[model samples]
Target: MSETFAGKSALIIGAGQNIGRRIAQEWAARGARVAVADISREGAEETAQILRDAGTEAVGLHCNVLEDASVAATIDAAEKALGPLDIHMNNAGILSGGNPQDIPMAEWQRMFDVNLFGMVRANNVIMPRMLERGSGHIVNTGSFAGLYPFAASRVHYAASKAAVVSMSQNLALYLKQFGIRVSCLCPGPVMTSSPDAMKHFSENYVMRAPGSHLSVMTQQQTAKVLSDGMEAGRILIPTHDEAWETLVEVAADPDAFVEKKHREFLAGDPGRPGITQDVIDSIKA
Candidate 1:
């Protein structure tokens, strides 16, 4: 929101991978003492090394978000290593790509564990502490897919994120009095793993031009956007500015947007939702 970072201690779960790693770097560059946490200690250490190379104070810790003890231990380790936690990024998540109904029960539960309950788990720890201290921020990673359950391969993934959105919204209201802010980053089609599958799925689930796309933004672009958006204390941080237009359009007249989008779906265009596979892939590439 104001982009304050100097002398702040921030813990980012899932800090080993692309988006999480980039966020760590960005925060480190801003002089925040970072806790690069992941399910694997080695991955976390690697990210910490990257931060250390840049001369930032950081520690790598292992925490399985699905387990309460593991999550608690990681939080304690982070606070011990990084000093008091002023910002907590609940970034741990899994992307299960495929039809929802056909997904294995194990996979579906895992999706909820990381994408929804994991977020809640982290927040349950950090937020109470924040409220007690009377000031803090919890940034949750959501997705544009959450906004509309596009008939993508990752239907469960979308549902999980939708839960995150709803949770963050309520938490925002609940934590406002404590001076603790809660925000969710609902970005569209980040260029991550499984590109072809993402593209194939986006064909029907998202809106996009044959070549143009709105869901995919550069990592750096999104990083910058996320940084600014978080600092601004926004509840929903969307990358493409025009995304708000669509959101507003949909909110004002859901029936119309649904009608138009459904028509596109029936016509087999599959590119009228929010993004295209090509756009998503190119952005990732």
Candidate 2:
């Protein structure tokens, strides 16, 4: 593909580790100057150093998306260091898991505070600037769970991501006249961490069945998908082939699709892990 991103300036929040870091690397590889922002100062600097070593103009900044002041400061520092951003992406989020009934309201609110409102906060800061400039692209990290009913035990997480999806699409409609692009990146499961760590997370938190993870891609692989989708100007970018296929199934027969997934959940299928009181208590503890 042609270098669509060359000479552009990009800012990625939550670029300290995993998918966000990989996406930042992808931007640099495409010849864009990048700012790596994360809650972890060390991780942000480490990512920035890696990009700098590779000869990319990059800066590391501390950005806690939950805090308005932090978000404002990070964007200001990045723009001062690297020029106005051509692309701004919000990738900060957390995954919490438990049965819907077992999870507390506080936990649900916390998830929204990070997953959905984090993007809202960044957009509130960046979108006005973009509107004045008459050009910019915004990417919000969502999950496939938000797009479908696949996440059996993660009701709160799914709800938060669903809100992200809604917000991104609507924002796209409103921003199109101003030449601002919005993309909601919804990927199924990317192996941003090691297998052991992911397994531990699933067992203790998500209650996902062992061997249930299918079509898991590396961060590089997932980033490539995102890059291609963004280049194509796709508003809703889903990484997995199965995600597309299942969405089609759902569209064709909503009742049947929901029924099948419900059955799978009840039957303790691969995606729907066996849930027990012990798992719920562990999550609570």
Candidate 3:
């Protein structure tokens, strides 16, 4: 393992499993002590155990992003165990799907609480410390849905992620003078667990992009890309090349992109027969 990050420490929220677990492992492999935090204490401990087994310094912590005090306590405990944090990653989020009309306002708030405000809560605590030190890296996990409004099924998730991207970019612009780096990771389809996991995720969590196919990457592959991107000081990192390419297309001709996206939405989902063309058209109007 490279000692590039040796003597450094990373505090990662949502590190129980999936992409979060992989990210914790990635940093640990690169020679950083890691604090693995998650809503599930067992999950966090499991991840920490894995790192320890691999000869890495690690600790498992329970952190509920929904609670302000839980987040504060976790960060405090992490620093006490591993010294000051060199990297703080917010990877806590809930995956949910529903038509825009069907999703209740309460549901929208819940989604925002986990997917958006969770990062906000952490930053509220960590940013001040980083600013005081005059150095730190903040990584926010977003989704490609944030960059493109094509995930018709996950309107709330997309919206929350869009907010994350916006916040991350703005923070990067402001924090540059302070020597603090912010990265927004917008990944496309990723097999965070088993190969079959993607299938389960597709059916339950998000709708596939219309007229575009995505290659699902493994957790390790996604983590490696994030590690490399962070090393290069990239503000925006998309795991899939296709996601980046689509963003370029959208930026180049937004009108065409919007029209194309709506056309796809209007076609309706065959699986979700409740989503009719009329419903989509009405939403557009």
Candidate 4:
């Protein structure tokens, strides 16, 4: 085993499946003791078993990001099992897709609760400990949708992820004095294990530029990209080349980028019509 992460301990929320599972495995392979947490106890145990089979020390625990008690208990359990955490990966999130007007207010709230506020909860519980230790790293999972607003139906999901990006940026700045680092992993469409999820993403959330190709990476590939970014201490880890380019373009010229997107929306050639003006007006009302 590599000594890169030797003597370190990691806790990955949502580690039971897909990209999160891959990340947990990667961390373990690099010599870190790991805690695999998920809403499903069985899933978490399965992931832990895989790591143990590979000669890594690991434990599985149930964690529901929507519940405060669950988050606290999971963190406590992880520490008890693996010692004080040196790396925290907040990877718990859910996808929400629908026309903005069609989505209920409750659903929007739920999305925020799980995708954004869940991260807030984790940081609240973990940052102080990390600060006291004076050495730690936090990796928050955002998304390409958050970096570029292309899917109108995924407005809630994008908003939640964008908040994560902002939160990671500010946390990086604030935690630097404490010798702690923060990274936001923003991956484009990744091929998950669930075909239903992939189909839903393809039909509702995938976005592309005019005449540009859409690329999808497997979970392992996404995990490798994120691991590389974290190793390099990059604050914003965009897994795809096109996502990085789009972000750079938007940063260089916000007005021009919006104008171009508007033209694309009008032409019906690029971008998805996520919500209508009527929905916006109604929300304002």
**Top-TM-score structure, candidate number:** 2
Using all chains and alpha carbons, the TM-scores for the candidates as numbered come to: 0.86, 0.88, 0.87, 0.87
Off by over 4 Å in 4: 1-4, 193-211, 265-285
Q: Candidate 2: what lDDT?
A: 0.82
Residue range 103-126, candidate 4, lDDT tens digits: 677877988998889988888899
lDDT of 3 by residue, 108-207 (tens): 8988999899999999999999999999999999988898867777678789999999999999999999999999988776654422332121334445
Return whichever of 2 and 3 wins on TM-score. 2
Model 4: weakest 10-residue lDDT segment is 198-207
List per-candidate RMSD values in Å.
Answer: 4.0, 6.3, 8.0, 8.3
Model 2 agreement with the true structure over 146-188: per-residue lDDT tens digits: 9877666777888999999999999999999999999989877
Cα lDDT of model 1 by residue, 5-120, tens digit? 77899999998866888889888887788998998789899999989999999999998998998998899999998778999999888774654446677877887988899878
Model 3 C-alpha RMSD vs. true structure (Å) is 8.0
* lDDT, candidates in the order shown: 0.77, 0.82, 0.82, 0.81
Model 1 steric clash total: 7
Please give the lDDT score at residue 189 for candidate 4. 61
